[model samples]
Target: MAKGVISAADQAEQLKQDGNTYFKKNRLGAAIDAYTEAITLCPNIPVYWTNRALCHLKRNDWTRVEEDCLKAVQLDNKSVKGHYMLGLALLQKEKYAEGIKELQRALDLGRGAHPNSYMVEEIWQELATAKYQEWERDSTKRSWELRRLKESCETALEEKYSRDDVSQKTDDTDEISNSTSEQLAALKLVFDKAAEADTPTDVPDYLCCKITLDIFRDPVITPSGLTYERAVILDHLEKVGKFDPITRETLFASQLIPNLAIKEAVEAFLEKHGWAYKMD
Candidate 1:
C-alpha cells in the first residue's frame, strides 16, 4: 500500500511537470486540464493548486483563481504566490481594501518568484491613486454640503424675522427666535474660526477677480483718451491692496484675471453709456 502511494505521488509530480510545460507553451486549457488531473491524483499538494490558479488567472477565470489560491494558502500557509494571486483576483473584482491587505501581505512575505510580482506592484500604485482621488472628491462634496447647510440655516432665520418681530411675538415664536439666534451665532463663530485658520499663501486668481468685481465696475474711456469711470484703478486697488499704474498695465498684459469676458461686457455697457472704452 505504501509503494502504491509513492507511485501515485510520482505520477502526480509527472503530470504537474507536463502541465507546467503546456503552460509555458501558452496552451492554457491543456495546462489547466493537466493541473486538474494532478490535483485529483494528489489533492494534498499545494503546488498543484497554485499552478492551477495561474492557469485560471490566464483564462480570466477570476472566481476559479480565487478558489485555487485559497486552497493553496490553506494547504501551505507560507505560500507567497497564493497570497499574491489572491490579491490580484480580489483587485480585479474591485474589492480594493481586501486586495490591498493581501497584496501588502504578499509583499511582506518577500517572495518574488510569483509571475505577478510586477502586476502586484502596479496594482498597489493604482489603488493608492484611486484612494487619493476618492478622498479628494468626498472632501469637496462634504465642504459643499456644509456650505449649503449653513446658507439654508441663515435663510431660514431671515425668513422667520421677515414673518414676525420677536418683541411682539407669542411664546412659541419667542422660543424659535431664541433658538435660531443661538444657532446662527454659533455658526458665525465657527465660520470666524475657520477664516482665522492658517491657509495657503497663494490665493486663487478667480477668487481675487470675484471679490474685486463686487467693489468696482470696469473702467470706461472716452474716444479722446479721457477716462470717465475709474473702474480699472479700483480693480487694481482691490487686487494689489494699493493701486500702481505700472502693475495695472502688467495685469492687463498678462491676462492674469480669467474673467476677461466679464470685463469686455462691462466695456460694452460703458460704451452704451456714451463712453468708448478701450479695455487694453
Candidate 2:
C-alpha cells in the first residue's frame, strides 16, 4: 500500500476545510475557488454548492447565489442553507412570493431537523420582508382588478340605458347601476383583508430597528435598554464607535444581549401568514 492513494472524497474534504479557512479570513474569492474545486471533485455533496452560494451571497451576487443554491437543493432537498440562500437571492430579484416560500421552508426545516435558532431568526426576518412585498403586489393587483371591474360595469350600464328606451331600466336596476363604485369598494374592503393571504405591512415600529427601519434579524438589547439589529449594531460600533444612537448613552458590543421576545413575536407573525410559506 503506497502512500499516494487519497480518495476523491478525502481530497474534497480537504478543499472544503481550506474553503472554510478562507471564508473566515474574509477571502471570499479564494473560498469560492476552493469550494468550486471540492464541488468539481464531489458533485453530489450538497454542502459544496451551498458553500459556494454563501460566498456569492457575501459578494451580493444574487444570480450566482440563486444558481448554486438551486443546485444544492436539487442534490439534497433538506438542505436548509440551500433553501435560505435561494430565498435571499430570489428576494433580491424581486421574486418575493417565491422567495417567501423558500425562506419559510428553510425555517421549518431548520427548526425540527437542523435547529439553528440564530439562523431561524434571520430567516423569519427575511420571510417577513418577502411577505410584505408579496402583499404589496397582491394589493396593487386587486386595486387594478377592482378598477377594471368598476369601469366595465359603468360601461355596460351606460350602453344599456343610453338606448332610446331609458325606461327599460327599472328603479332597482338604476340604483344598482349607479352604485358600481360603491359596491366595488365594499368588495375590495372585504377582499383586502382576505388578500392578506400573506403577511401584513402594518408591522409595529417597536418591532423594527430605528437604524435600518426594518425588522430585526437578530435583535440585541443594549445596556441602555434599547434594542437594535445585531449585525447593524455591530457595524455601527465598529465604524461609528459604541454609543446608543437614540439615547446617546455610552455602549459596548459585549453589553448586547439576545432579545428573545422580539424573535418570538416575529415567528408568531410568520405563523399567522402561513399562506406565504409556499412558493407559487
Candidate 3:
C-alpha cells in the first residue's frame, strides 16, 4: 500500500463520518451527498443507503427513499432502518398492505434486537396505526356491501309480488310475509351474535395493568417505557424485585414517571363505557 494513498474503505468511513456531522447539523443536501459518495465507495454497506434514505424521507421524497431503502435491505435483509424507512415511504404513497408488511417486519426485527428501545416502540406504534387504518377501510367496505344486499333483497321482494292475483294473493302474501319475517329474524339473530362476539366486552389491554390484569387506577411509566398501576408497581418494587416484571429489566423507584397520557386515556374510556367499571 502506498503511504499517501487512502484505501476505498477508509475513504468511505471518513465520508460516513462527514455525513453524520452534516445530518446532525440538519444540512440534508450535504449529508445526502456525503452518504452517496460513501455508498459509491462501499456499495455493500447498508448504513450508507439507510442514512441517505432518511434524508430523502425528511425531504418527503418517497420515491427516492423507497429506492435507497430497497437497496439497503437487499444488502442486509435484517436491516431495521431499511425496512422502517421503506415502510414509511410506502405509507406515504398510500400502499397500506405493503407498508404494513414492511412495518411489521421492522417491528419484529427491532423488538428482537432491542426489546425496550424507543425504536422498537416507534415501529410498533407505526404498525398499529397502519393496521387500524386498514381495518377501518375494510369495515367501511363491508358496511357498504351489507347496505347493498339489504337494498337488493327489498327490490327482489317487491318485484316478486308486484303482479300477483288481487283476491287469492292476499292469503298467499300474508303467509309469505310471515315466512320472510321469520327468515329475516333468524338472519338478524345470527348477525347480532357475530357482532357480540366481535365487540370487545373487557377493558382495553392498554388500560389494564400487566401485574394486576385490571384497569389502571393510577398509571406510571418505568424506564423500560412500560406502564403499570402505581400501587402495584410500588409494591413489586418493595417486595417482589427491583426490576420491570414484563421486560425483566432493572428498575428503580426513582425511575418511575407519571404516565399522564395513559391515565387520561383510561378516564376517557371509563367515561364513555361506564359498564366497564363493573367488568370484573
Candidate 4:
C-alpha cells in the first residue's frame, strides 16, 4: 500500500498486457520475451507460462511448449490452457495416445469451468480431430492384422492337407475336414469377440439430442439449460423461429452455449462402449 511503489503482481500484469499487444501484432519473439519477463516477476501465475507457451506453439517449438505448459499445469492442475497446449505439444511429437488424453482433460476442464466459452468449442474440435486421426491409424493396423491372419490361416490349412500318408489318405481327408471346421469356428470366434467389445448398449435419452434423437456430437445449451445438437438447433432456429422446441420459450442463437460437460460425458461413454469411428 505504498504511495509510489508498485507491487510485483501489478508489474507482471503490465508485462502480460504488453505481451498481448506484441502477440496481436505477430511479434512472437517480443511477445515471448514480455511473457517471460512477466513469468520472472510472478512465477506462480499459470497464465504467464501459458502465454509464453502460445508463442512457442506458433514457432513450432514443441519442446518449449511442452516445458512451459507442464510448468503451468504443475502450478494449476485445473488449467485448461495448460492441458490444451500440452496436448498440442505431444501431438507434434507423435505421442498420439498421451496427447489425446491431455486434450480430453482440457475439454473436460474447459467445459466444467466455462461451458459456453470459445475455448470449450476449440478443445472439442481439436479432440475430435485427434480422435479421428487415431481412428485412421487403428483402422489401418486392424486391416493389416486381418490380412496377416487370413494368410496365416491359409498357410496352416494348406500344410495340414499336404501330409504324405497314402495308406490313410481317405481317413486323413475325413479328419482334416473336421479340423478345418474347427479352425473356421475359431476364426469366427475371433471376429465375434471383436464385435462384442465394440457393440454399445442402448443409449440414454438424456444424452440424445431432441431433434436428431441421436447421441450428441456438438451439444449446446439454451438459456433454459436444455441441451441440443448445435447444427440441429441452429437449423431449428432459422426455420422454426427463436424458441425452445420442448418448452416453446423464447430462445436465441446468441444465448446458446456449448454444453461441454455433456459432451465430455458422452465422449467418455463412447470411449468405453462404442465402436471406432461410430461417433464420427
Most TM-score-accurate candidate: 4
- Report the C-alpha lDDT of model 2 over 49-123, residue by residue, as the tens digit: 999999999999999999999999999998999999999999898888788889989988887774436787678
- Give, for candidate 2, the lowest lDDT window spanning 10 residues: 271-280
Writing each residue's lDDT as its tens digit, candidate 1 over 1-280 gives 6654567788899999999999999999999999999999899999899999999998899999999999998998777778878887887886766775776676556424442255444444444443333344444565676678778878987787757665546757766678778978998888656533222122223322332332123233322332322444445546764524443333232223324454466444432322211111
Q: Which stretches of candidate 3 lie over 4 Å from their true place?
A: 161-180, 183-207, 210-280
RMSD of 3: 8.7
Error of 1 at 110 (Å): 1.6
Report the C-alpha lDDT of model 3 over 1-280, residue by residue, as the tens digit: 9899999999999999999999999999999999999999999999999999999989999999999999999999999999999998998888988998999899889867875567875786676567556655655566676667766765665555454435456668777666666766765675556343223346789899998897775589998789998767888989999999889999998899989999899768744543222333
How close is every model to the real structure, measured as TM-score? 0.48, 0.58, 0.69, 0.72
Give candidate 4's error at residue 29 in angstroms: 0.7
User: What CA root-mean-square deviation does each model show from the true structure?
Assistant: 20.7, 7.3, 8.7, 5.3
Local distance difference test values of all predictions, in order: 0.63, 0.80, 0.81, 0.84
The residue pairs that clash in candidate 1, if any, are none
